[model samples]
Target: MRTTPLLVAAPLAVALALLPVMLVASGAQQVGLWSPWTAAPALATGVALAAVLLPRLDLPRLPWPSALLLLALCAGLGTWAALTHGEHLVVRRDPGAYATYALALARYGGVPLDPGLDVFGLPASDPWVRVGAAANYAVPGTGADGSATLLVSPQFLVGVPALLSGAWLVGGWSGLLVAPAVVAALALAAFAGLAAQLLGARWALLATALLGVSQPVVLVARQTFSEPFSLLYLLTAATLLVLAAASRGQRARLPALVAGLLLGAHLLVRIDAVRELVLLVPLVALLAGRRHPAAGPLAVGTLLTGVPAALATRWWDSPYVASVASSLGPLVAAGAVVTVLSAAALLLGRRVARRWDTTGVPRAAVRAAALLPAVAAATVALVGVGLASRPLWLVDSREPYLPGMEQFVGALQQQQGLPVDGLRTYAEDSVVWLVWWLGPVTVLLALVASVVLAAVGTRAVLSRQPLPRWLLPVVVGLAVTVLSLYRPAITPDHPWADRRYVTVTYPYLVLAATATLAWLVGTGRRGTRPAAAVLAAAMLLPTALATLPLATARTETGQVAAVGAVCAALEDAGPRPAVLAVGFRARVEWAPVVRARCGVPFVGIEEPSAPAGTTLGQVLGDAAATARAGGYAPVVLVGDLTSAQTVADATGVTLPPVVSLRTTEPERLLEERPLETREMTVDAWLAPLP
Candidate 1:
């Protein structure tokens, strides 16, 4: 088969070209200096760099047929993503948080947002006043000297926001909304490139199609989530690694270095990407011992970006880092151990190869290795059985960390008509979660294929032969997938939790399943090839059936219009230099939107039960008094009529809602798959300070 470097290089180029843009934007934001101007120049420089350097790699062109297929897949998926794209503008979940972060970066240029609190002249020492000043994701705190208050920063890293900010600059909100579709298309192309390198072009097309059509892939592609960006980076990195491995001499070093840089860049995209970085250490050492010319460069390239990203995250996104510190600490320790062990093994292996004689090895050991494929297959089956049976015997629950998370879960359970168990994680049903989306057939096939591939990898290791370039990535992907499934540290809600699968599991399984079919087709007798093809075609049925329900059902519909209505109402309310203080229920979902879209200073009032020192009425009275004194109109905002009445009573103002609309929100499922969205009414009441 002819090499098709352009197929992979094209998508990789796009992502690599944006690397510097993300870095520069993030670095600028670190010093509160980020803006569209900063990103534009960085983007131009990155494009120019990619144009010059990528061509110098001298990658071969993709065949026209393969190119056409890739184009078709991207076009189809991109169109679907656009038509069904979500309007997750309300900061209720990760997608909303990401969108708000991008909005802040695009509009305000940086975080630690100044909500003009100094103008309000409220007592910062008042606990209730402080609670009212906080927004979801945008944690509120005082400045260095602890005198002035500011929205401390946004959660998660700057990668998604930095990238999305460029889209916002070019096309405003519309561009930001459709940016994920573009990312999805690029990610699909990258996945195809990696698949084409490992399998043949025909099989790669099948794999790409399978993955592209999967529900989880489609679900995330429609929203502003980090998974799509992470997918693009990881797939591009793997594709480049394969290209590097296939090349010889100094020619191989460039792609390997680029691959390492991409993996390092993944750190910017995801804090947990340190796992991938750690996993690369052993693979690099193994390749080095095999006399691979690219190994050293790969290591050097990773350190180039990885070191800076780590330090930057620690400094700028410290809250997010601290939030995941429990998991991150153990992961880091494990990585250190793996790095040391891998280095020792690499050294010890070289010595053994030079001194020991393979001829003295027992024949039984070889026979046991030969049976590895069977052993692997059985292990996969047993593990699946174990996980599938977990719900039957296990009742999993956990303490909620996020404020009001338990209450939120209880509400969802009440809506779903289940026994209200606020603490129930439903984590034990994680395997069943996979079955809900991938279907039993695809899951089984993927498991078998994964294990079989591992068996083949084991044999190569024992024989001291250089491992397949794709093997390292596959192994790392599998390890991470397993870990994610075991502990998906997200709100245990369907579709929301499904984003966990999008990062690696869904793509990896699609690749594995397609590869398995390809193996069957290639190894079968000439006459049996058609039968194998029929079998392969038959296998897609379960996945197609699984995806049929949500293929066109758009979630979070009408949200954009709802938010726009609120912004418009706020603007028209004759509130020059207005400050919007949202009620507790609205704070998490609308505080950021009010500030970013309405272009007004915003604050969030905590729930009535909050441990804040003052009553809700006192907080409202203070907010009103401060706003009048500062010559700014103070508007109260709430998400529902109940909350609006609560605020109205507290302020002694008859607050009639200014904005009332209903939008579709993704449904929360307990033990079943989410098939449709539920209607959610969004109400916002704006009243003058009394």
Candidate 2:
């Protein structure tokens, strides 16, 4: 009655592959068309299923040609992402800064200001204060004599700018758009390789496939953001650290050093990654020291790489320092400080271990030391709770873009007559929402895996046993879970996937979930494997369904598109330098985009209000006069009809239409109401001369 593993897995593989086809067919039927492109997902699902199952089932390895074809199919999808929808729609000024940074870095070797660039309504002497502030400065500084001496870069890091600079150098503006895609592709490949090393090929392929389709990957990969680089460096560091632990002799030392370098370098990619260093340094120290005396090398490597980045950040005066101080409570910040100090103490004591000729400290002591940071982090987080305490839920959760603290506290909404509930309810709903978006089945498996792995690591440490192979992953998973759990405000928006807070840990999560599912299915049992395969297939669909739009969307569907159309129109309006007057609502974002896209000098016109004793027309007239005086010819103004009418009424001049673009449609994708619009007809006209 003996049966081969391949024989047992064949029916399950076939069954799992067919499930996606059925889902796709059903989806197509509901839409009433079976287009060729629609079939691609089903085919991809089948191929991915085979890729995961065949080797695990001990089937004959596919020959080189088949392997190459499969590899090409996967790689092709990763590459196409850069071409089709790589640039996610820009909704705020921050995104535009990436282009500015790229251009600045390429030309100036830093983000130093270029006053000659058509930024801040060039040649307008009024300071265009609104425009100035958005550009991170105040125009015409109110210095005692009214000289503009002050400019600011705001609370931002230069990581993304630094990366974009290289792209600008390579292919100029267009290359900047393509840069994120390249970084994303590399990240996917690296993630797959890391997964294979830690969780085996089956898990690796599954995680890689999921990441390729994940909304976060699709959106962030093409946009000028620091997250992609952060993920790449984080994954690389973890991989190197894992290899160092698994190897011996000098082999381990090199990886340990390299691992430290990558981890330290990660700071330059994303400042937020400092949070991970708290856990990573201590974990690497313990794990690498298990079989070999590599802890010293790891510590030294981390210090050597980390110190310069820290010093540079201090010298640059991180824009985020103020924000972090304001947003993060004292206790939370203190806990983070304590965590770093603890890791440093452990590393320094590792040297002391050599002095004492000790194998290691007692197991109880080691476990207690490791637990110190987590305990402190949790206890200190309470201060934040007290500072912003409110009912967990409110009846009228009307705003889609409410602040995180408000969502958690519900105090403001409650004061305004919305019903509210206590903290217990909020905590419960947050947990459920997280599980729902992450996939109920996947979350269940991950939970089981985390608990089991954590217990094993704890027991091994406390009982003085050889370090378990699973300890590194356990530490990583715990860190991610703890970080995610602390964020009280929970939003389950599909495109943004608010639960994607722990994206850095996504690879480890997939490994944990996949390993648990594999064990549950009992690979040796022929009958149960099919059931496990079905369950595994089901978990992936929800995420794909939710994130597919995000993966495919290059630009938002509503206001952003309309605004882009206007910018494109401005671009087509010829090479003449014009002082385009934009309405207040549009100016915050439009000014930046128009300046970058249309290469036009822009004037920000205030709405429904003007400086005291100065009429709206006088302001418009002055802006136009200044631009014309500064040599900008055929001065043109672009704004909503109301703002245009305001200029016409105040100046008592006839307005001639240059062009007019439509109002942004209601209910558009990715529109943040506070910063964007769905109302207001935008018009461009020849400015009436003073």
Candidate 3:
């Protein structure tokens, strides 16, 4: 194979590149390998140069040189973004939970909800609600400090935290900073490899570039999000499936089984992947079965991996079940069931048609077999809708946080709205904003590519011959994309703009679009090549232009800056004092960060909503007593202005005036000033209790 060198070099290079991760994963005695600054840009430049120079050098005529370069681009840029532009401290409460999860994984090999380990260098003496979801609630019991240890949420799948833990092992707090971007690069590489095989090298390369610079990718890449890992798994499975479908005998069996393993493993990463799997696994099996007998092995492989993961979900302290029990949960379950049943019906119908063809039964009867499932599906959907029409559990479940159907209908009655407003409104607006991110040209080209792929797929399916090579990706991509639309808003507040919703599948959309263009602009053509090149350049120009801000943007800027300021203020205040966190939101977000970064044990004041809540005086007195008993000279009370007033009204102690700290000053110690900044203030006041 012309690409043999690339195939070999790609894996080897990735392995060599990820040596730091390998060492951490293997429990090497050493600490981190490369400082983010020292290693990231250097690697990025090297890989990028390889992309530009490797093909021109004419070394072994490696296939997919462009794709390799794109991989490098994504990996390099992602790493660079992380090292220079990343936030080391926990910003939002979610990342804090993951940090705790990573800490637990690093220290204990699994989550010990109440590990009592030193987080961010502070011992877990008095546990307060660490904020975010209830899943992170470590203890239902009260502690000696009169505060219960409401820990960080454990809502996420273990995959991301487990990966981040490796970073934790390698570089402590800082190492995990770039974990998301780096993992996103892994996803880009996986996609590039798959695209090179399915769509030519040029298309794969363009796809990689598009994904590398896109706003969504760039945004998610820099954060401690899980979608990148999920994307990596999905792309890997797709790659293996492509290989399995194309190969024969044992060659086919291995990839097929591995593909299934990866597919099943997806469940362990994110519960939502199950919706895609329900449609995808069966589709792959049917497609592969047509060419060869790989479906059985694939199914077996899936069972091998998926069963244990399902069992773990049931047994583990994961919030997946509880969260699912909410409205988003049933919607996903229904979608999965519908997708699987739909696929099964199609397969069963095909079999029935073939069997009846031999017996010479009425063609109508054969068609009815397939149509029966479709009818059943429609009936089920109607029943569901009818049930939903009344005050049903599913409809009722969604009301508290999001706009209910009644509200949606009222909005529609007032003004005609998007059919599924929650999902559609976000998705529609996000796409437009994404175009502004990737440019209108890229978005338009991608849409064209989707149409072209769809047309090609229709032709292949209608024909008697083997399905076109492009049809596989087309089918999978289209199925996944459609299923994505059905995704009931997990985050109603943010809706589709929350890039996590599309990160896994967005790369494929770009790949298909770029590949279609590549196919149109074959090297053999004269004017075609330049014209296609122009189109490709137009598609990428916006992405390139937009990359600077996206890559350099400060994620969770307000929160991180606040935490950094607090850390600075605490460190500057001589000896470490016991911190009293006064607000619910403050304690949830900042308390953990304070303890972790400053090694200060904190006493949290319960929110007014809590049972047996005391007046402001009791809250102040408790905090003072806790600090005094802990043998701390001064008690640092922190909260936003509103909470500060509550503290003032309840306390007799003459606390100092609020101090304003520069967010930039503390952050400079970790990396240079962020390329962009936000206007936010972190105010604090202190009191010394004799």
- Give candidate 2's error at residue 544 in angstroms: 2.7
Per-model C-alpha lDDT, please?
0.76, 0.51, 0.54
lDDT of 3: 0.54
TM-score of 2: 0.69
Per-model TM-score versus the true fold:
0.92, 0.69, 0.71
Tens-place lDDT per residue, model 1, 232-329, is 99988877787787788898899888888889888999877987888899889878888889899899888988887777666444777776676677
Tell me the deviation in Å of residue 325 in model 3.
4.3
Best by lDDT: 1
Clashing pairs in 1: none
Clashing pairs in 3: 120-596, 136-152, 136-153, 324-329
Tens digit per residue, CA lDDT, model 2, 1-690? 232333113323433343344334323422333333544576577669656734532222333443333345346655766665333222333345565544444443432232332332333344343444243433333222244443323224555555565566667555777776666665665566566555555655666776566555665665666666666666656665666666667666766665675666565555565666666655754654453545666777677656666565553344445445433344346546765776676667668667646665667867786785455444434432432232353322332222243454355335445455322223323344444444667666666566666655666654446665456645765675555444432333223333244346456556677778767665677777787777677667766775654444444224335445655555554445554454554454455445444555555556434445655665666655665666654344544566667666777765566545443321122112111223434445544354
Ranking by TM-score: 1, 3, 2
Off by over 4 Å in 1: 1-6, 58-61, 130-146, 315-317, 357-385, 398-407, 580-582, 607-618
Cα RMSD for candidates in order: 3.0, 12.5, 9.3
| Order of candidate numbers by lDDT, starting with the best | 1, 3, 2
Candidate 3 per-residue lDDT, tens place, 519-544, comes to 77765676888888888888888777
TM-score of 1: 0.92
